[model samples]
Target chain A: MTMRSLTGTGMTEDGMDELLAQFLVEAPELAQQLAEALLALERMPGPGQALDAAFRHAHTLKGSVQLFDLPPLAGLLHAAEDLLGALRAGDRAPDAAALDALMAAAGAVEGWIMGLARDGAGIGLPAEAAALGARHEAALRALLDGPAVPAAAEPAAALAWLPALLAEAADPLAEARSGSQPVTALHYRPAADCFFLGDDPFGLLRRLPGLIALRVTPRAAWDLESFDPFACNLDFAALSTAAPEALRQHMRFVADQVEWAGVAAAEPPASPTVAATRDPGQRLLRVEAARIDGMMDMVAELVVAKTGLAGLAREAGGPATPLGRSLAARGAEIDRLVAGLHRAVLGLRLVPLAQAFRRLPRLARELSAQLGKPVALQIEGEEVEADKSVVDALAEPLLHLLRNALDHGVEPPEARRAAGKSEAGRITLSARRQGDQIQVTLEDDGAGLDTAKLRRVAGERGLLPPAELDALDEAAAMALIFRAGFSTAAAVTGISGRGVGMDAVRAAIEALGGRVSVASRPGQGTSFRLTLPRATVITRVVLLRLGEARFGVPIEAVAETLRLPEAAITRLAEGEAFVLRGRALPLLRLSDLLGLPAAPAGTERRILVTAGPAPCGIAVDGFAERLDVMLRPMGGLLAGLPGALGTALLGDGVVLVVLDLDELAGGAAAPLPEAALS
Target chain B: MSIALEDGRLRLAGDCGVEEAETFLSMLQQHPGLAVDLAEVAALHTALLQVLLAFRPPLAAAPGEPGLARLLLPLLGR
Candidate 1:
């Protein structure tokens, strides 16, 4: 079918873009809701309110699609609406075939929506959608004619007879077993109100891949005298040789209603697994990230202006005067309001880690299948929220870590058995909030890091000197795995071993003001922990003075500040050093680092100790009050300057340059002053 | 509006909908064992289907339309 143009729909190009953007954002959520409601309806089979809700969703989606001049998608949704409308109006009883048709329509619409997202609205509908639309129309017609084929005829009565069904499936199950396919028994008890959501449980059953045998029975005895046909009272048990992921995908919409177990050659295990139900009405709003960032910039500026106002209020009469007191009171009020505004804006950028965590299970499943290692993924604290930018940046690093775990950390089934562990290895991804930071840890219960091998690899790759490698402790040796060009993998695989795995993960995390650490036990497991700031808008910094200029250093980077007399300073071959509590720290003057005029003879100097793998002490003229400030990264001409974290405006209208200590400590070859050498 | 009761039998015609379900169910409740004749039922609504399934009265005659017969005959255990 030929696609219609936006112009023909009487929408301006910009307006069309706006509408399409909104549609792209909203259509997927609506489709998901419809699918969930439909699955619920199938389980329960006839809730009037659910039917109405399903109908409304279909109708609204159709209207939206039609407004964009997409006839095929609109038509598909329209057919679904007709079916749902019929059920809602009580003009047609809920039936499997009808629901199947509606499901097909919904799927077709979903495809079109995805297509629109990938290729613009100008893209034409595929032929499959046209076929689906035809089927939907036929199903609606059949429903209008009368009940369609007795709704696939409920399975023969008596759960006890399931043994017979198993016998019938024996041949196919045997074939699956012989072919080395995993066979599983599935028990599905849809929500009782599934019909109201427009779900047909039998229809879903019919679509199960690699199906071998099936039995259907009511959870409770039906009372013919007072039977409510609309209420679903059915339970389905089936044997299938489909991959677990396929089964999971098929039942994702109604996950809470399914119990599945691996079927062995012997009697099938009777373990019952219940799916977790997510609250349906969790409120969410989608706003453009750029808009939020814009608002944040404004808030930062407002904070700076408020600080300037407070300074002015102080200068007006000093706190002792009545005028000064009133000004101070109002200034305090504005400060509180601005603080609240800053928090609210920052919260707008917070997103749950589940956004990235949801994709890992599928990845683990696929990788395990490919590598011939059965790995089960366990996720926890997925609901922990972090900055959206951080979450987006996290996906790649996490993927790399998981791939590394699957390829090298996890052992094959036979090997795991020999090791006295379950044949199925486990990889767990968990997140937790600690203070103002979110820590995400990925751990695998498999062959842990071989520290000896790591040390040898590090030495072989020249990552560490031979003597240093010999003196490395277990933790220090494990840290060698993150060094660039160091890999312990005996043979490189496409998944993870070009000698560039953990280092990249560390780099990505550290780029977000976070840190990565590794801990492993020889035969037990290995874990990578990433701790990142919850948000990056406002930062706490310890203000410092260098000559007449002021600077700021992040509090996280500052381990402690010490007042050192001139006598405590010691000279090293490369630079100045200071002894604090028996430990000598390499010290660099802030004035020398930034090329500012040296401080005049000082009464006393303060040293700000920085923390990291290698600690350093930065000597400054004096320490100023530590305060919270919105740090904005330098733009344009100063954007790429090394050692500059960002700049923040002080209360007295001075711009305090925040130093990136990591970069400054690591980068010292630019220029040297003769005074520092002496 | 598309249904009428005559001679102790419920005769249904045209399209029966949710609007008609309560009255039909009340009628069936009032007169148990009443037979149903659907010679003219062009369409059946879910509410009416509920009434029929719950009441399960004997059908005076099978639905005239083959499509309709295919739907209702097995359901009625004919």
Candidate 2:
């Protein structure tokens, strides 16, 4: 009989690729933790939990780093691990310089992690950077100044696994005796926290050429209630025809977990299979977004197919007929199942906002160091969940907001004392889920936006005329920061004012069908709030008709829909205007926006009012049912069409183009917003 | 549901991941006499396998993957 592939999961199973992918995802998190924890430990005195955690992160990082071919990275981590071990052992007192060196090492590793993500081996990182790792190693080693103190993990006692494995694969073992290769036996009990360290038990064995027999068993009984899907719980025992050195070399990463019972000839045996042993695990599986998106596409197709099944069934026979009834029942079952499947597939794409928040603390540390402005960043509700795409897209805008806070909104430590505020400025990044939306706000305690300066900047930059700038209220003036080419900073720093303005940040958030608004009270500092959908695939859109052509716009973009009398709308040379809530709101005819003939006039005009960077209203003929649709971004020749969000396939077999309200609300060439309040 | 008990026959299809293990166990415990059908199971996670090992429900059909079936059938004493 053919031996099992030994590669767990067997689907495109390049064990190295999977392990590297896992490492790339997990290591940066470790690096961030290592930096943050050490930085915290330095500020706090005595041996506390953070010290232990710092050591654990460093030790865990080293374990994963040593397995790869990058000697410099591995060496630097090795030295850091030893220093941490010494600190944990109370062999030496923790000092700021040592902590600083360790933090620098963490920073280097964090940088290398990005390069590692691009390529499993070395990416095109500069040679000096790799050499810098060695230098960090030398610096850390000098700080360490002793024989490495190895914090060996206690060996897992797995006596029953081998005998069970031998019993299960006894026949394969006897059959393999005829083979010439020197067989070796090993009981690989991976560290319980291996998954956290990116260790795949069977993945480590993928390199072993010959696997005559194998068996997987749990290290302990499964506790039904406490089963952690992220923790590594399985013990793998295998008999391979490969030499002991080769087996040991491949298992080097997890050398502690393995008990080498050499010479398989002396033993009674185990071809292999996958997924023999595992803990329900503590960590979530990192799936490529493309995989889930592909599944979503299939599920969408299923949705379309299932919608027509009843019609086809009714055509075959009347609903009263047994055949028709059976078909209808089957169709109903498919509907429920498809709906459940859709939810499940969407759930796979739901990642905690922590994914976006993890990197920001490191950024705060770096920026705080760079500016010499002591700022305390407090993040709350990071456990809030959002779609992977949405969470991934959030980092850019969030980073910019944070940088803007530290650089501009937050006052320097001495300056804060002069303002009677605490010496250390506080910036809070809070997130919360509100119905179908996730609102993330970054608030900083610094000299708040100077509306006077904002208006002056607006006037000088030609973003708006001085008359219009003066007409804006305090809140309206604060919103000018998001206007194209608006920056109040007198001098450009390496951070927020690096050519890209707040307008880019606004665009990024709006492109995701989200809203970004700023609020400030001069000396109290600024708060930027971003309201984004919890998921991207199934966006809620209001379907409306303009001159017989139906269109859809994301509901989040439409602040409110109203009916206005023709007398309310006064025609201007630029376009049209209507007064609402004591403010002049620019109104655009939807037909005119889409270049279609105007809708026949009615006593009352149906208007879709949007709250965006430039608030405006679009007049439409009629409104239809709001739907949650899978929005496919414009492709082929239709790409980059302004005001078009994407297309959605309706149940009636029509493709509805969802409008990008923000883009439509603020296009220079578009008829919209020329008469806008400016 | 990837793991379903229909008419006392528990069926697992496609890829049975660890996420389903908790429900699979509860269902196994709830219906003690439910036989299993892994005929369409493309891949089985270790958590589900351990649960199967603990329960040892009678098999309605051998696993679809030959390699998996070979190792699992005997362990289940089928």
Candidate 3:
């Protein structure tokens, strides 16, 4: 249940090294856990559990630092232990003051650990680290000397006798109520080089608040003669009834790297304790990711089979037949069961969005600082969940947009103040879900896109005619920013305004089955909202026919499908245009966009119109059917076609090309012959 | 947070603002051994002051003799 498993185990060199490496890796994670726990504790101050976590964290940090004579690390850790010790005593509560100091000290210790890990360097504490320690040490001296803090003294005594008493508790209710209860299990793995960082994992765990159990095992076992004392290869796990939160806070300095999770009452794990094992380093289970993947693959097959059965049952004559009725009923039941299982299987791939959110602040800060503008990035909705694939593809474009906002949307601090804004411009990055889509919006408070400047830049980039730039509406003009090689910056800097352009950002999002739109006011800040499909499994498309070929058009791009009379068609200098209620709409035949043979249009052909800065109509030979289907991207040479999103294999086994309206709407820069296009 | 020096320690009490923490941390530079009194401290914000404390002074910049430097280096040095 705790470190007791390794009690009699002889330590080995290799085991010790592995244990130390694990600790080095876990320290930062523990620190992060502490931060989160402390934040939670502030919200729910009555939780005794937070105090316990703080104690454990400090206990671990202190213990690990002791093995090596890393004097500086030990001193700070010792101070943190004392402070957390006071809080656990219940005589002194963890107020914001103590928490801040504790967190700061933890961070310092983390830096020290990191420094040592990088090289065999000594932790050089900042003046404040020493000052803070002095402060905590003074407080600790006061508390240790004062009347016995009940919780602190109780743990000391209870831990001393907990092991013998917990084994003797016969009844569950009695066990729960007993002061000797083991409420938690702690796992500690100190890196082989832990001693170099002045960390002693064993000593730290030994000082835990309610040490009902303790054990030390090497990361890997080796002959005792070859056991390297300098190599911190031991890992320790302990069980105690002390609150988890307090233990977390006590070890917040290296919070980013440790992993901590609660142990269920039923999963004590029968591993030999530190004092019990002959060779404490041996591990019993090592589950490979590939094996889990194999299990998931089998589950997926079961789902597909269940779907087939349901389909077969629907085709059966009637439920009146006894066999048919039973089969149908079972089929329906299996459908529901498989659906639930499918969700659970898919859930395994969902990860918290916080993984990406953490990297944003520093990025925002750096861009803002580089631009001589003060921009604060406000991130929210971090708990939103998305598949790992989506999260992985999101990082870069988000960074690009952040850079774009700083480079173009925000003004210098002085400029901001002159415009009646705060010196620090605000850039907010937020994610929200609507239906089955996730929208990530980046908004800034600087002067919105300089339309005139954009127009000038567009003209310079040859994206627009200088003479007609003034005639273009704001939305249409703003869209120019997405054009390739577009840059409004007076001069290119290391950050942005390069040829990569917003087109790159648009391309990135589109690659993930998403679309990006910009909304802004001339003097107000601009907002870029990228709406992405939650997953790539299924796409919603409006199916239409061009002669004998059926094509799919994404629902997002289709504003409406109108059955227009031939009279609506009007000829323009550039090409054939259509007018519906006096608005001039450019028309691009679906056949022409797909490079398919143009079919003779019927008197009443359906025109699918798109919505954006520019609306375009695509005339199909006939209207087929609209269905949402799974679209597999076309590979090889066909992937380069901008107009084609992908292709789907329909139930009839016919391959239908999916149209990318956004790309088609980009208009003809180097148009092929009108006849050849179709 | 209310911070002042008492008995050679930087005595801190009351709720500490992140912005003000920076100023308080700067004060510690002149008085490195300043001890803080959190007994009456109501709140502490993990801002510039905390970050400053957490920021280990580079060993290359550590003062020659062992005093506060000695106390702090081991906690932060590699």
- In DockQ terms, which candidate is top? 2
**If you assessed candidate 1 against the hidden native complex, which CAPRI class would it receive?**
incorrect
Which has the higher TM-score value, candidate number 1 or candidate number 2? Answer: 2
Error of 1 at A631 (Å): 4.5
The parts of candidate 1 lying over 4 Å away from their true place are A1-15, A27-285, A498-500, A543-551, A559-571, A579-583, A589-608, A611-615, A619-627, A631-657, A662-678, B1-78
TM-score of chain A of 1: 0.60
**Alpha carbon lDDT of residue A629, candidate 1?**
83
Report the Cα RMSD per candidate.
18.1, 17.7, 23.9
Per TM-score, the best of the predicted structures is 2
Between candidates 1 and 2, which one is better according to DockQ?
2
Q: In candidate 2, what are the lDDT values of residues A67-99, reduced to their tens digit?
A: 555667778888898888887776666777678
Model 1 chain A worst lDDT window (10 residues): A268-277
| A1-678 per-residue lDDT for model 1 (tens digits) | 333463245777778778877887778756755654564465446634346557878888877777766566676677678778777665577777666666656666666677766675566566576666676666655666555333333333323434434544544554565455778777788777776776666656656887766666556765656756566676777888888899999988888888876665432111011011122335655667899988976787787677665667778886888888888899889989988998898788888776666446556756887899998776656557888877877888898889999998999999899999999998878777788899999999989999888988888888867987999899989998777677677788877875567877876676666789999987899999999888876778888887777789889989899998877787667777776676666788877877777777576678888877667788888888777788765556775566777777665667788888877776552223434434
Runs of candidate 2 exceeding 4 Å displacement: A1-22, A120-125, A145-286, A303-339, A537-551, A555-572, A575-628, A632-657, A666-678, B1-78
User: Ten consecutive residues with minimal summed lDDT in candidate 2 chain A?
Assistant: A268-277
Which regions in candidate 3 have their CA more than 4 angstroms from the true location? A1-342, A464-472, A522-524, A540-592, A595-628, A631-641, A644-657, A665-678, B1-78
Q: lDDT tens string, model 3, A1-678?
A: 113221113556467556655555555555544444444344334325456666677777778666544455567677777767777666566666666566566556666566544442223334455565666455444544334333432323313323322232212212332233446644555555655565545445545665554443345654333323355554455555678886666545434433454433421111111012112136634343366446555554564355456456656755757766777899889867766765665566555555555446656655765777876666544445665556667888888888888887888888888888898888877776666678888999878987778888888777766766778898878888877778777778788766677888877677667788898986689999988766545456788877777788878778988988887677656777767566666777877766779877667668888866677788887676565455544556774557777776565556678878878766642232334222
Error of 2 at A511 (Å): 1.9
